[model samples]
Target: MNYETFENRVLPVKNKLFRFAFRLLGSSEEAKDVVQEVMIKVWNGREQMATIENMEAWCMRITKNLSLDRLRSNQRRATDSLTEGFEIRQETLTPHERTEIHENMQRVNEMIAALPEKQRQVIHLRDVEGYSYNEICEILELDMNQVKVNLFRARTTVREKLVKINAYGL
Candidate 1:
């Protein structure tokens, strides 16, 4: 890929890359660094870019790998901020309603963070990033059955926990 093509194709996916990294690393700064590293790797491997059919999925795979590598090297647990990827702001809602929404979002994030790594990645790629099952399978290098199974388990776990929280205030 030439510089212009790189700029057009690769640069546009930076946000998606960063978001995926953040979901894995749980730190914006680390996510930014991962994104920079991904960009450099992509640029250096431009000669082979033509062989890749899905550029966005390719970038996402790079992001996932780099983020996991960073996580393993650091040996630190990843924790998502409540504000990440959540927007409860609404001008029309009363203060009480807004607070309720924020609380619900917080609970959801906590539940997601508590999931196993594979389930977490599958859920984030499918639900938060809006990737289809095929795209998620490609990005995560998993088979379609694995992707669907993880997604189903993640969602089911979250739903069950939410029900318990609401029913018993646990």
Candidate 2:
């Protein structure tokens, strides 16, 4: 793609790209690096994008691959900061309410983080990023049936954990 075309087509999807990267890496800094690497790779390979039907999905796949590569090379999963999360959330509620909400949010986050890698990725792409099943399948390079199954299991797992936490305070 030319400069103008790239600006229009690729640059606009940076937020989606960044969010997907952040979800995968769990660190904003690492996600930013991944997005930059994805952009560079896409730019360099612009010539090969001629027949691609979905550019966003293509870029997402690149982001997923690069993020996974980084994770593998480092031998660690990315971590989100609970304090940082609490700081950025809305403060409209009373202190007590806010604390409760924050605590619950942290619990949910922990539960999601504890999921297996594939389930985690599929859930993030589907729920957090709001992508359709087909898009998720494309981005994660999974078949449609696998994507649906993983997402179903991930949501079910999270729901079960949340119920347990609320019911018994475990």
Candidate 3:
């Protein structure tokens, strides 16, 4: 319950919490605010913190709930969304090649974002964050079967969309 204990145990998961929050809320500022809120909430409830087994997961669950609450409070059907940016080596490829790659990456990102809500959340938690099924279940408050089914359906939808793009050159 002390500041030192909370710092030692819970502070380390800030980045993970930020990423999860950002993934849900899709704005860096909003995500940072959510992470701060999560930290404060955890600190306030520090007396009960030791009862939890996985501190990181617990923090993540709080981040998820807070992020979703923010979304609902805003009453926004859509978020600003995030793009996965990467550096270009500038070695073996021409500007045309780089542009093509960037376009493809953006297309893939749009496809994922277009997925249904539950599918997108499950995909992000499992694929992007690399959380286990049980952890995702806890975070999403879903059963194991529902998590797996959502993940499977999400993957299939992505694959099908990619195939359409590649096959039709669309």
Using lDDT, give the best candidate's number. 1
RMSD of 3: 2.2
Candidate 2 lDDT, 1-170, residue by residue in tens: 79889999998889898877776778888888999998899899999989899999999999989989988887887666434534635657788987787777788888888888899999988888888999998899989999999999999999999889879997
Candidate 2 Cα errors over 4 Å, as ranges: 82-91
- Stretches of candidate 3 above 4 Å error? 79-81, 84-94
Candidate 2, position 132, lDDT:
93
Q: Which 10 consecutive residues of model 2 have the lowest summed lDDT?
A: 80-89
lDDT of each: 0.91, 0.86, 0.85
Q: Write the per-residue lDDT of candidate 3 for residues 33-135, one digit (tens) a residue.
A: 9999999999889889879998888898899899999988986543454554466667699989998887887788778778777898899888888999999
Estimate the TM-score of every prediction. Answer: 0.91, 0.90, 0.88
Q: Higher-lDDT candidate among 2 and 3?
A: 2
